[model samples]
Target: MNTKKEKPLHSLFAGATAGAIEAFVTYPTEFVKTRSQFEGKRESPIAIIKDTLKTKGVKGLYSGCTALMAGNSLKAGVRFVSYDHFKGMLADSQGKVSTPRSLLAGLGAGMMEAIFAVTPSETIKTKLIDDAKRPNPQYRGLIHGSVQIVKQEGLKGIYRGLFPVMMRQGANSAVRFTTYVTLKQAIQTRMRTGQNMPTSVTFGIGAVAGLVTVYTTMPLDVIKTRMQSLTARQQYRNSFHCTYRIFTEEGILRFWTGTTPRLVRLMLSGGIVFTVYENIIAVIGARSPDK
Candidate 1:
């Protein structure tokens, strides 16, 4: 096995590359997911997808591919890099706090990732989704929208709702990486009979972990979506203040409004993500003669 320092950056690089490819495949569903989170209505995420498609046709669903490709690649790169770095850091932390230590590592990894990349990408992505569905669309297309955001709002507009974004992404990634690591370790233990634990087990664990992360931190996710969808001026007036106000005023249940659809979405999305990610990694490992 390659030591932390010695291991190729293939996992991180490949993970990001895979994520970008995957993002395009499911970008339409993702647009629906963001809108559902923001609208905070009791409607299902699928309903949101259907409605958008009906109103705007298939063209409407893929409103923000540019934002997604840029943000998601950065997000994926940061996440993979952080997960690897944190994993290395925790390797020396000790036994009693092993899992907890790993969780913390994952948390730190995710937090930094949210700060630098994921949050901003989420903001741009959300705005484009809303913009496409808005009465008077601000952006004609992804590139045009991006350029306008940069021109009118400056780079910050591109990163409108970074706070709750951090919270949502940080929480999501923490659960994902930690769960993946834990499941990998557990499966390794069961590998004694020359029979490995089924890939289903790992994928299932990842899906459950994803659902937990998404639902637990859902309120923040909602806030992030709403904040991002706002215009730059509207966003600047009071994003954090509004987040708190929404929580207090909307009833806590409001935060969980679209949670069921989100759960289903995450399970399917995350399952595909992990399956593709692991297979890619395995292929990379196989080609390495030293392995």
Candidate 2:
């Protein structure tokens, strides 16, 4: 087993690489998920895809890919670096992290990423998607859209849905990390493989973690998307108000509006991200003189 401590830069690079790969591969699913949430009336994923392709062509399915790709890279970098930093601090003298400590570290990482990377990127992506649906699209591209949003609504516009984003991300990381680590450890112990499990094993574990995260955090995800939307100010006064409106007007099940597409995206995302990140980190460690 490699015992070398992972440098922050390595984690950042590995995470960023993993995130970008995951985002690009699963962007169409993300597009469908967002569109599903955008509508007041529920639409199946099949219907959404057909409509988008019919009206806007194949490129429409990647409407916000650039913003998400960039954001996911930055967000994943920050999240992994922060998680490692916090985990190191909370590790016992033997360098073992308990589940509770792991959860805390994940929470910290999630909150940090939400504020520094997720909120702004997600706001931009959501807004772009919203604008694209308009008959007369207001924003031409990512840079122009970002500029227009800031110009019209100021910094607050770019940071819309900060509260729900933080909540959703925090819970997501806490659950994902803890679950992944626990399952990995259990499988390692059973297999006596130590920390050098096969890539397939890592991917499977990560998929399970993503599955858990999607269900647990779906409601928060919906609220965050809604809050960051173009019509949020007119539709919802705040996070609580948004939740109330979703529940009262749209019904309780509405909170999971995009569950199918989101689930598919995240499952593939988890598998791809963890597999890529772990492999990169391993390669980095092997190249280190100290290893």
Candidate 3:
């Protein structure tokens, strides 16, 4: 009869675990998503997939599943923890929740999440995705790719697109969470007394937020992809050198090449990711045999 227990903690841990598992399960699609965004004149996603399947089969899709799991575990864990902590911080500072405070919650959560988890994850994730469709194709699998990148480029190599990921993902978290909170409150108030916002609305809001973010950050993403994946880790010798070359040579437009696919991926990915995470949290709380 000992029901006085920690349900939110379980939900939090479950959400993190689920998110990490989902990252790996969807690794291939994510790999495709990233590659689809990084293509240029002669590079097409279909061509990349066909070539990859022809050359590698299932391995192509699951290329970065391991790195993805690690990335997502940390990424999701930090996100959930930060959102909770940030919300608490805001509540304490401002005395109560308001629309502006909700938005601030999103902004702070996104910034901190990126600072904590984007670099190493993006480096490994991008490299794995890139190697799958690389012109010369240097890696055999995620393991080999990761090992080679580290050995040749040192520990720094694994964080190639750190800044861009931080920018894009940070903005993404802020926008997505803000949209979610705003929509949730709007829904709550609009309904007469007992009604709550429907799940579909939450998803829609998340999609909108994701769309806004991806479009804004698409250019930076393309550059980051090229810099992280296509470029040699050892060649740049440092992140700054690689970034400088991309900026000076590729021009600005080149930075936005794979924008369309990225938008699509973000919309779908963001909606599902937030929706799933939220639902899973709810389920854990409800099902835990505790008050």
Give the lDDT of residue 173 in candidate 2: 92
Q: State how far residue 205 of model 3 sits from its true place (Å).
A: 2.4
207, model 2: CA deviation in Å?
Answer: 0.5
In candidate 2, which residue pairs clash? none
Q: Please, what are the lDDT tens digits per residue for candidate 2 over residues 231-260?
A: 999998999999998998889999998999
How does candidate 1 score on lDDT? 0.68
Task: Report lDDT per candidate.
Answer: 0.68, 0.89, 0.65
TM-score of each: 0.85, 0.95, 0.78
Task: List, residue by residue over 124-207, the lDDT tens digit for candidate 1.
Answer: 677778777777887787677778878877988877776677677777877776676676666666576445456687568767
Better of 1 and 3 by TM-score: 1
Per-residue error at 112 for model 1, in Å? 3.0
Q: For each predicted model, how many residue pairs clash, with residues at least 3 apart or on different chains? A: 0, 0, 1
Please name the candidate that would achieve the greatest lDDT relative to the true structure: 2
lDDT of 3: 0.65
